[model samples]
Target: MDILADIATTVLSQLQKPTLAFLLGGMMLAALGSKLEVPTPVYKFVVLLLLLKVGLGAGISIREADLVSLAVPAAAAALTGIAIVLLGSRSLARLRGVSPMDGMATVGLFGAVSASTLAAAMAMLDADGIAYEGFIGALYPFMDIAALVTAILMAKMAQARSRNVIPQNGAATMALGGTGSADNDGPSENRTLVRGILTDTLQSGAISALLLGIAIGVLGRPEAVYASFYEPLFRGLLSILMLVMGMEAWSRLSELRKVAHAYVLYGLSAPLVHGAIGFGLGMIAHQLTGFSAGGIVLLAVMAASSSDISGPPTMRGALPEANPSAYVGASTGLGTPVAILSIPLWIWLADLFIGL
Candidate 1:
């Protein structure tokens, strides 16, 4: 009875957040055909600030964490990201009859983490006075890059097998839906390709903020000054960001609706399935390492999120032949909202599993 009460309380409180309220408001206005808009630059700035603040805050907390404690969770988190991609890809391809390249793109998008979702999850944990491991944010890049690379490899292998050409240097001679080339561009091209992708991934505002925050947390003493600014201002920034996101999502509702019903199903189900799997895995990690309920919840949140900023561009660049609307619409349009909406449910699940 107490647990049920706690779940209800969590759900209500999460719904009442200013950030979530703004998100709903944005969606409502869009439905009403109001033309109010958040300037692109302004939205970008707020999102950047939000991510940086969260990352730095996490980093500060992470300094006291033992690497041994984080090792299993981090490894599990990365593997979970890969597993979700493989599952999403197979389901998209076999179930929906989507082409291999397009399925891989979907995998890439749904497999990676969403920075906004992470920020929102942390905010919820904080609001509820739940204590989570801050170093979980460090797993962000591992999961992000892992999903991208796996998707690329899957696409490469499928394309190669179709053409009966063994990939020489991997992803170098293989373009999506294009003939595999026998020419070895040598390792130089492969190295260059990896370098370029890394550069782009690292350049994302959220990622860069996380990385910078980690650096500061590890190397500097700005916690007192930084916390003063980040703690108080974080939710407000996230609120504005969510509002903009809601408006953007609402505007794209028509585009999302046009996606295949099968894909729509996949998008809706991916987060739920992945998040459940993630929570189960977190439970395993907890048994192994005695991690806190909040840390487990964070792991679950990481797995549940669908990528918004990082996954799409990589997919667009690699799988140009794929339908942009299908992947983008499915992930940003369906998956993200579902993940955000489901946070409370995950919290409840975490409690059941870990006794939070």
Candidate 2:
């Protein structure tokens, strides 16, 4: 508990600020169209470690050295987590009457991931010598794509609602999706949606590294465990990822002043709700899917991670209505990890109660 508390304070207070600054700077440059960019290799490296850490951590925990035994649990867990995210988000959005964008933001968040948090958890799990599997991390990219697509659709819905209204400061130009100006003005957006997804799948570029990692794993190549080269590579990547992620966090916090209450509420509630839902979902999936307890636990963990990318940034970035960064920082930095750590203990208590 103390360790978790320390992580929460350190991550939210220290790390997040830096993450924000860097990302905001990068985004502004991208949006305003500054040529300055994080190096391609650097971006890829961070994302790679992000995937590796999660995969290795889970792989180390599963200890399926033969690679064959890993299949059942990984499959069961991934399917369960994805299903919960997809179905749960759509349901929640409709119920809340949140605009399509909000629903997408909410639901999309359920799929996007936090590479940093996953990396940290993986490292801890690795050090503890717990055997996990690659499949868990492999699923991350798909999760990302799902979230992004959903967000786009949601954004489109929100846009449709906006109709003919003139957005402040040529808002149409800044939006994504190769979208034309809302008032039919300015240069059109590059049709990156399908192209982006395809490029990611085929080229293994910055936005699609997770998919690359997944493909590598799916093809039965978890051999990185025995290889020594990946560790140094990961260390180099983590430093950059952490530094940039920290900068992004800093920038994100500045946005919080606009919607402090909603941010705090999301921060507080999301982790607990998501965690419980994940745990329950994992259990149910286990029974239905015939996966092991460890496998089920992993599924639950994935579900808890539903908010990884979308949930946090939504709170932190553009929309003041829901501060995703705070939600993520507070939850992932603190809530999810604590939840993961508590899971075994919780199960033990549950078993004890049942026995009594």
Number of the predicted model whose lDDT against the real structure is largest: 1
Off by over 4 Å in 1: 1-10, 167-196
Put down candidate 2 lDDT per residue, 113-212, tens digits, no spaces: 5555455444434443444444556545544555545454445535534664325434343344235445544223324433543343334332345454
- In order of appearance, the predictions have TM-scores of 0.89, 0.54
Best candidate, TM-score-wise? 1
Query: What TM-score does candidate 1 get on C-alpha atoms?
Result: 0.89
Candidate models: Cα lDDT each: 0.76, 0.46
Candidate 1 versus truth, CA RMSD in Å, comes to: 3.1
| lDDT score of residue 244 within candidate 2 | 52
Candidate 1, 326: how far from true, in Å?
1.0
